[model samples]
Structures are given as C-alpha cells and as structure tokens.
Target: MRVGLYPGTFDPVTLGHIDIIERGLALVDRLVIGVAINRDKGPLFDLEERVAMIERECAAITARCGGEIVVHPFENLLIDCAREVGANVIVRGLRAVADFEYEFQMVGMNRALDASIETVFLMADARRQAIASKLVKEIARLGGDVSKFVPPMVKNELLKKFA
Candidate 1:
C-alpha cells in the first residue's frame, strides 16, 4: 500500500492542518500524522495532549476520506520517523514562499539520508493559508477567538490551556 507521513509539531491542531490531511489522503492508502516531539520548541501542549488533539480532529476526516489515519508521536529525526511508520512519501503543506524556502532545505537533507523516500508539497487552501498554530495559540492566549482557525473541540482545549 502507498503510505505517506505528514510530520508537524501540531502543538494545537489547526484547520490548516486538517485541510492538508484531508487532501493528502487522496494520494495514499494510509496517512500517518507524525507529531514531532521537539523539546527545543517547548510546545505549549504536551505530547499526549497534541496526539489527542490530532486524533480528535482527524476522526471525521478519516471517515470521509476512506483512508487510515494514524497519529504517531516521535522524538527522533523526521526521516527516521517516516521509516518507522513505513512511509515512502513525506507530505508537507506549503502556506507561502517562506514555507518552501525552509522545506527545500529539509528535502535536500532527507534525500541525502534516504534516496528511496520522496517528499511532496501540497499548497494550502487559500482560505486556510494564513492559519498557523503559533498565531492561533497567540490569539487564543490573548483572549481572541480562534474558532476560525481550529475546530470547536480543539479551540476549547486551547482555551483551557490558556485559561
């Protein structure tokens, strides 16, 4: 089966992420959402919390898309995580040219590590392109509405964190 891995910090799952997951499932039989454990970033949500949020948000998407969605949490290198999940394609979402600049370097390193695995970039839907987790969190923390950026469940969880 064609398996793809979509890796992200997902501190708090956002609508932008949901868009990518829904679209990425079209190309693969299984899509693993690799939740990265980046201690350096000191994410607002813990690993368990992040995983829970992703699972909750992806539930309906998985059902509607007719593909298996796995939420895998990893603290290792992204390429290693991809191999562990048996993913041949690493799917990434591009919001703007800035995103591509960073992703370009990552693709180069990943290719050098394993030439067999490939990376695919999916441009974000224009409506959701400006929605980022960092910005979403900041807005929520400052008592602003994040309903547009995240699902109600996720927004509630985020509000609790800021509360």
Candidate 2:
C-alpha cells in the first residue's frame, strides 16, 4: 500500500487543511495526518483538543470523499512518526514561493534522514492559499467569524475557548 504522511502543527485544522487532505487522499492508498507537538509555539487549543478537532474535520471529509484517511497525534520527530506508521512518503502543502523554499529545505533533510522516504508537495487551493491556522485563530479570537474557514466543531471549540 502507498501510505503517505501529512504532518502539521494544526493549531486548529482549517478548511485549507481539509482541502489538502482531500486532495492528498486521492494520490495515496492511505494518508496519515500527523499532528506535530511543538513546545516553542504555544497553541490556542490543547494537544488533545487539537487532535479531536482534526479527527472530526478529517472524518467529515473522509465521509464525503469515501477515502481511508487516518488522523493521529504524534509527539515525536516527524520522520520517526512516519516510520512508526510505516509510511514512506510525506505530503506537504505549498502555498507560495516562500512555502516552497522552506519545504524544499526540510524535504532535503528528511531525505537525508531516510534515503528511501520521499516528499510530495501539493499546492493549496487558490481560494485557501492565504488561509492558515494562526490567522484563523487570531480572527476568531477577536470575535471575527471564521465559520467559512474552519469546520463547525472547530468553530464551536474556538467560541468556547474564547468565551
């Protein structure tokens, strides 16, 4: 089976993320959404909360797309997580030139770490090219509606967190 790993902090998985997940699922037999644990960047939602939100969002997408995509949280090196999940490909979303530059470098490092592993970049949908979790959180924190950007479960969690 062609299993691919899509790793992200996913402070709050957004529609843009769902778009990428849906698109990535098309190219692989199985797609594992790996939620990275980062200590430096404090997240708006706790780790478990973020994982639950992503699970709900991806579940909804899977139901619509009819694909077998697994969502899980990992608190380790991305390559390690990929290895643990028996995945040989890493799927990344590229939004722009800047994103390409950074991802390109990381891909190289990942390749060095595991020569057999490969990285694939999927361009973000034009409509969501500029949407990110940080922006979504900021907008929602300020009482701005982000119903269009995130899933309903995430929106409700944000409302409760900020309330």
**What is the number of backbone collisions in each predicted candidate, taken in the order shown?**
0, 0
- Per residue, candidate 1 scores C-alpha lDDT tens digits across 1-163 of 9999999999788999999999999999999999999999999999999999899878889777678999999989999999999999999999999999999999999999999999999999999999998899899999999999999999999888889
lDDT of each: 0.94, 0.89
Clashing pairs in 1: none
Q: Write the per-residue lDDT of candidate 2 for residues 1-163, one digit (tens) a residue.
A: 9999999999898888888899999999999999888878898888888888888887787888887888778888788899999898999998899999899889888888897889999999999999989999899989999998988888998899899
Off by over 4 Å in 1: none
Best by lDDT: 1
Roughly what TM-score does model 1 have, to 2 decimal places? 0.98
Compared with the true structure, the alpha-carbon lDDT of candidate 2 equals 0.89
Q: TM per model?
A: 0.98, 0.96
